[model samples]
Each structure stands twice: as structure tokens, then as C-alpha cells.
Target: MTGPTGLGTRTITPDLARGLLLALIAVANAHLYLVERPIGYRGYPSGLTGADAVVAVVQMVLVDGRVFPLFAALVGYGVARLAERAPESVVRRRGIVLIGIGALHGLLLFPGDIIGAYGLVILLTAPALATSSSRGLLAMSGAIGVFVVLLSSGASGPQGVPTVPSIAAPTLGAFLAGHPGEWLVTTLFSALLTAPAVLVGVVIGRSRTLDEPAAHRGRLAVWAAGGLVAGVALGLPLALAVVGVWSPTGTVGGVVAAAHAAGGYAGALGLLGLMGLLGSVSWPGRGLLAAAGTWSMTLYLSQSVVFVAVLAVWAGGLGSSASLVTATLIGLATWLVGVVVAGLLARAGHRGPFELLVRRLTYPRARTSDR
Candidate 1:
């Protein structure tokens, strides 16, 4: 058990899982800066060639719309873990810090940043975090299920004109150049999309299931299997569209989109389950990943920083026409750098820079050495 603000006894599984998830997220996001193709679902390119086509196909099946939810779940897990021991004010401070960071991240780096969404979710779900595990679980499950049902049933939310960011040489420059109103709209949409997953994550955190994966093998396995199946089933149609196998239109398209979105939750749960199982055994790269995962918050922002520096139109400008294979390689390289940085930090017994920053912000009264 960890103290509210303490990093506590670091669990190998969540860190390892998060490290892996970060790589997956890298692969998923690597192509977003490429302005050559039309934006499609999950940011998949509409046009593809040779190995790029193959990469796109594989990403659709396994990567896109998958890692975010898993990451969100981890967010909830972290919040719940802290909430179980820390004061509500402390947790709220953490949430506020995240929101501030996320807003800055969006304004300066990636427009599609999920950090802001996660922060909002934490703030919104603070009250529920204090409830008993059963009650929290019920509320989480009910809200998610109801939202999914509504979307799949073809109901609509408030209608607004879809806003698309323009292609600009410096991608960061483009985000900066975009209208503030449009950015806010997109950011709000992103936060709404991420709310359910974060709530579910909080439920997972509250249960402490990941703390002892060996004891939860059966439960983890079942969740993994069921989640994989449900996710694939719901997401198949959308995946088909992504890879050029099918095109969905009108209300049917909307329903498929909803199912695909809901499928992300299942996919994330399944991945978490798999990670829990892997933690039960000593797996290769586990050490490296665990190290990286520990620095997840810092590294997450670091990824965007690196992306902007290397691929932005005004920067490296390498992403405008990068093939899927090329982008994937770049993403992998980025994640590898994170692994190295994390290893170094772990050896020094230091938190990742941003991680420490947030900790300090959240607990200003706590000693600097506390984290």
C-alpha cells in the first residue's frame, strides 16, 4: 500500500503495461502530422501504398483506438490508488495540475492531446472516487454502458459543424495558427470522448486488481479474452473502412462509429488483463518497460515535444509524406529513447521531470524529497 502522494511500492505490471501502451500510442499517433492524406477515423490515412498499406491494415486491427483507453484506465487506476490513501484536496490538486499541463500541451504541441481529457475526468469523477469499490464500479459500468447504448442506438448529441485543422508547414505552427475557438471545440470533444475510459480506469484503480496479478490470473484472462472478442466484433466494420475494405455512410456509419468507440474500452481492458498476466511471469524487456512506465507522465509529454521537433512542418518536416513504415520506425525510436531516459532516472532514484513537476505542484506543502 502506498501513501497518498508517495510513489509507493512500485508495481511492475502497471508500469510495464503503460510502457508498452506508450509504444502502441506512438505507433498510433505517428502519422497524425502527415498532411498528405485525408484525415479519416482514428487518424488513419486514406491513401496508402505497399508496406504503408500493410502497416495501415495492421494498425487498424491492433493499434488505433486501442491504446488510449488502456492508458485512460491506468489514469483512473492511479487516481483511485491515490484517493484510497490521499486527501481529496491532494487528488484534486493533481487533477488541476494535469489539466493545466494538458492545456499547455495542446496550445504548444499536439492538438489531439489526451492529457487534458484525463485531467477533466479526474476532476469530474472526484466524488465518485470516494465511494465504495462496488458502488464506484456500478456507476462506472452503468455510465459507460448507457453511453455506448445511446450511440449504438443512433441517438445524437448536440450538433456542431465539424472543424478540421489546416495543413501548415510547422505543424505546431499550424496548431498555433488555427482559430482558438476551433481548438477549444476539438479539445472539449476529446475530453468527452475520454471520460468513460477514465472512469472505468478509476474503478480498476479502486479495486487494486493490478497490484497482485498472480492472484487475479483467472479474472484477468477472462476479461482479456472477452474484451478482445468484443472489441474486434464491434470495431471490425470501422477497421474495414480504415483500410479501404469498406465504406460506411449516414446513420449506419454513425452506429458503427459508436460501436467502434465503445470497443476501445473492451480492447483496453483486454490489454490491461494481458499486462497483468505478463507481470505474473518474468518477461523479456519487462525491466526496461517498467522503468519507462514509471516515468509515463513525463515521457508522454516528451513524445509530443520530440514529435514537434522532429516532424513539424517548420521543424524537421519529415512527417508530411512519411510512409507508414517510416513513421512506425520513428515512433519506435522515440519510445526507445524514453526507455533509456527512464532507465537512467530509475537508477538515480529520481522521478521523470514532468512527473516530479506534477507531484510538486500537487503537493507543494510536501517536502521536495517526498516523491
Candidate 2:
């Protein structure tokens, strides 16, 4: 299960599964950045067209709120993995770094910045959830997530896209100074919204269900099927209903704006099931994805920067009033650009630049001047 450097103890299947989770978003975001760019899906307009529309339609049908939850779940699973590898004290310290990163990440929430919110979730929730049993924590987290989605629905009337920074001002300064109770609200938001995914990770870590794919294929098949039906049935209407309905004001409206966000969550789980099936049993691209997933934190942050640069008004200006289809094509091109760049970098034995920085910070030392 572990990677080659003895650094990866993650079960290969689960690692691959989690890797798949991160990549799933690339599909949609590529479109947003390169094609039919949306301001937000929470309550605002999602202006899709052609391929952008097609991707959106498919995402609405499949992956919507679902991916983040999966990401969160994997964090939970990873937390478990960390605890097993080190003392609680060491783990807690690591947890703080994750939180710090997340806090910083949240500040970076602009059209260009992604995965910052995810950093927030790992920081805020993992410490508390770490104490509970996998199943118990997941159940608790899922219930809370459901509550947030439902509660948000009745309040704001419509919300914007969760991942896209439609309502959120595009700068760290804005989130800090402009938004009232931004810290408290965002912290609370991350906690309730992300608990299930983190918990799901814990459950998977605890159950060791994913590691032995061959042994559990039958169970996975059943769960995947069940997830497909339930996820779609619940996610579709809610997502479509909220189209062009979001407004970026007040707590209630924000919650309602998260309907599409909720659907995204459901779709993420369904996708996990789908991807797990494909990657675990028979994926030609598993090695590449696995490699990318191995250095995930590095790759993730890099993607954000790379994506923005590619889509920015200055660089390629692909973000210039393109339809969903056009944007998707742009996104596809951008993705190829990223994959090739990442692959070449990986081949050179360079982990993500960020990953190297974190490693240095986590374990610093003085040079032996005397020697």
C-alpha cells in the first residue's frame, strides 16, 4: 500500500481512490477556468454552454458537492494513518500545520485559489474527529453535513457555488476585513459541511475496507450501486433547482446557495464508488494517478497556481467570455498542460515545491559548521 520511498503506507487501492477524488474536480474546474466559467453554483448563475454545459449537466448528474466530501473523507482516513505512524503529540503538531495551511488557504480564496477550504477542514475538524471511532465519527459528520445543507436551503433562498468564489471576494484581505465573523463563520462552515467526508476517511481507514479490493469487491459493488441511485436521486433536482438562484448575502441565503454544493457532495461519493471500481480493478492510468496522488499536496497547490495562470486574463485569457463547451476544451488543454508539466517534474525526482517546503518546516536542522 505504501509508496516506494517507504513514506507511503497508504493502502494502494485507497490511495488510488483518494487520488481519483482529487482528479475528479480537475474535470469540472478546468471547464470553469477555461470554458463556460461560472461565478458560483451556490445561488448565482452557472452560465453553462455546449461542452461547459455538457460537463455541468454531467457534473450535476454525477459529481457536485460529492468531491469535497470525498477529499475530506480521505483527510480523515489520512489522519488515522498518521496516528498509527506516530505519537499523538507529533500528530497534533502536524495537525496544527494542516490547520495553519487551511487557514492560509481560505484566505487565498479567489478565482485562482482552490484547495484552501480543504486545508481549513483538515485543520478545524481532524483534531476533534481523531478521538472517535471511524464509523461513529463518520455518522456524526454526515449528519452534521446533511443538517448544514438542509439548513442553508431554508435560509438564504439561494447560495453561490461552494468551490467557486462567486460570493467570496477575491483576496485574503477581503475575507479577513470585509466578511463579518469570517473566521468563525468559515470555521463553523467547514466543520459542519466537511465533517462527513473526514469521517468517511476515518471509517475507511479503520475498516481497512479499501486496502483489500479483491476481498471486498462484492461489498464495494453493492455500495457503489446503492450510492449511484441514492446520490443521483437526491443530488439532481436539488442542483438543477438552485441553478441561477443564488444571492451572495446573509447567512440564510448562503446556506441555500449551497444546494449545488450539497449535490456536489453526493456526486463525489458516487464518483468515489465509480472511480474505486475503475482504478482498483482495472485502470491503465493508475500509475500516473497514483504518482500524482502520492505527492498530492504538492500537486494540488501547484494545480491551483497553474490553473489560474492558464485561465487568467493576462496569460492565455481563456477565461474571456467562452461558452461551457469552449471553456471545457480550454480546460482539457489546460489539464494536458498540467499533467505533462507534473509528469516531467515528477520524473526529475522533484516532489511538489510546496511539499518540499512543508517537509523542511516540519523537521528543521542546523548545518554542521564545525565539521
Candidate 3:
């Protein structure tokens, strides 16, 4: 049998999606560091008006709870590809390595790290992922979907009160003290929340949906159109509530939040389908975007580094005073810089530092020789 497709032969769609949507990840994460404001739903600061409120609404609709699922799906797709060429042990090793890296990242830099959670999910689900039938995959996804909805529905915070303050730690000592517990809890929770998307991505990868978009154009178009429409419509109520256009209470609020979380999966699918559709086309800066995607892991970690340097109180001390608008701009600028750096790296024939690390640990010479 043919071995797995190498990076040189990998499709563009997944990387392209990662490259572009990572900016949304940056934007979504940036505001969570704003320490001076009262925290509200979904970690956004409360009592906003004017540009900040508008930005909040837009973020809720387009960015929040959306990018990560898409990334989880991409990771799943990658797992599937690896399973095709390597033993299950290798896949598990990769997941383990990611968890270790994520732990360090969480404790030292950002407590909101998802890499460890992804690793946990992969470690737990690798068996099913490698051997499950399509029906089995769908069943797993359905079960996880229900869990996500229930979790989201039950999630609540006192208005104008920060639920997770460690993310905005006021001092180096405080950050070190608080992040370990915070990381542990959030990593587990994130694993549960993102599992459904990852399973669905496995199904997509099995079908080579993104890899062979030309063969699935009609289906991709439908997913792109329907998923986006449904995602936006479902997310609108929650977005409005976040902006204080209307206040939802009791059952209404729970239902709205549940719907928003569900919509995030649809949004992820829509975005992936859209990227698949765009895979064969040429555009200005497409290469640069693809390069960034290729170096996604490094870029992801770099964002946290930059955010900590510029926004953390113990570092740049801007988080205590930065407005939502300022945070969003910073996110955009960070993404732009990352893209340029990724492009330069690609031109120089270098892999992302983190990617290189993962590859080295995942495919050691002894292991490869044995295989």
C-alpha cells in the first residue's frame, strides 16, 4: 500500500483555513486579557458602548467559539492521515508530546492553552478514531455534541464578574500561582467541548473532503452556504445579548447559549468548506497565507508570546488599561506579522520551530527505522 501523503503533497485547503482563521483565534483571545473591565458572558468585558460594543458583537458572531473547533477538526484530520501510515502507538506518542508541550505553555505563558486538551482528546479517542466505521464516528460525534450543548447551557457567570481571573493575572507571582489549577480545569473542559468537532473532522478526512475538494465541489458548496447561514442565524441572538441589545434570562439565556455553541460547529464546517472551495484558486497573498498555515503551530504559540509580552500586567502592563478596540487591533497586527514571518520562513526552506520539535519527537530515527 502507498504510504501517507507527505507535506509536499498535502492539500492546501486545511492549511489555508488554519492560516486565515488563526487571526480570529488571536482576536478572540486578546480581549480576555483586558483586566480592568468587569467580566461578562463568554469572557468579554461588560459595560461596553460605541466601538467596543460593536467590536464585541462582531466578535461574538464571527470569531468567538468558532475558530477553535475548526482547528480541532484540522487536528483530527491530521490524526487520521497519520493513522493511515503509522502505528497507533505513534499517533498516541504525538498526542502525549502535545500534552507535555501544552502543560508547559499553560503554566508559563497562557493558561487558556488548548493544545493539551487536544492531546487529551486524541489520547482517549485514538483507538476509536483509527478503527471506527463511519457510523461509529457519527455516533461518537453525536454523543459529544450533546455534552457540548449541555455544558454550554449550564455555563453561567455573574454579570460584571470575572469567572476566570487567572488569565488576566496581575503579577508574575500571581500568574504562576494561579495558572496551574486554571490550566488543569480548562484543559479538561476544552477537551470535552471540542471532541465532537474533532470526530466530525475524522469523518471528513476519511472522505478526503478537503484534500480532494474538486471531487466534492457540490457538497462543499452546500456545506459552505448552509453552514454559514445556520451558524450566523443561530449565533445572532447571543451576539445581540452580549451587546446589550436585549437581555435573555433563565431558560431563554441557557437556550441561546446552547444554540450559539452548536452554531460554532456549523461555523467551523462552513469555514472549512469555504476553504476547500477556494483551494484551487489563486489570490493575492494566498501563498503567504498558506505558508502561515504550514507553520500554524509556531504561529499559534508566538501569538501567546506576543500577547503576554504586550498585554500581561507583569510584562507590558497594557491589559489593565487596553480597550477592546485596541486589543482587536493588536490581534490583527499580530496575525499580520506572523503571516509575514511564516512567509519568510517558507522562502528560507524552514519549518516552524514548534512543528520541527513535534516532528522530531514524533518521528525519532529509531522508531522510523523499526517501522
User: Which one wins on lDDT?
Assistant: 3
- Which model scores highest in TM-score? 3
Report the CA-based lDDT of candidate 3 relative to the real structure: 0.83
* Model 1, position 38: C-alpha lDDT score: 66
Q: Per TM-score, what order, best first?
A: 3, 1, 2
Ranking by lDDT: 3, 1, 2
Give the alpha carbon lDDT tens digit for every residue of 171-210 in model 1. 4556576635544665666666666777777767666788
Residue 287 lDDT in model 1? 82
Provide the lowest-lDDT 10-residue window in model 2.
362-371
lDDT of 2 by residue, 1-371 (tens): 22112323335666566455555656555544432333445322355444444456566656555666777767776767765654455455555565565555444433323344445555555456547665667677768777877765654443334334332334345434532344445555656677667667767777766667677677677667877676776555545543432334555455434555565566556666665666557657676655556566665555556555655444555555555555556545544555556645654555666555554454344221111
Candidates 1 and 2 compared: the better one by TM-score is 1
Off by over 4 Å in 1: 1-8, 148-174, 179-183
How does candidate 1 fare on TM-score? 0.90
Assess the local accuracy of residue 305 in candidate 3 as a C-alpha lDDT between 0 and 100: 94
Better of 2 and 3 by lDDT: 3
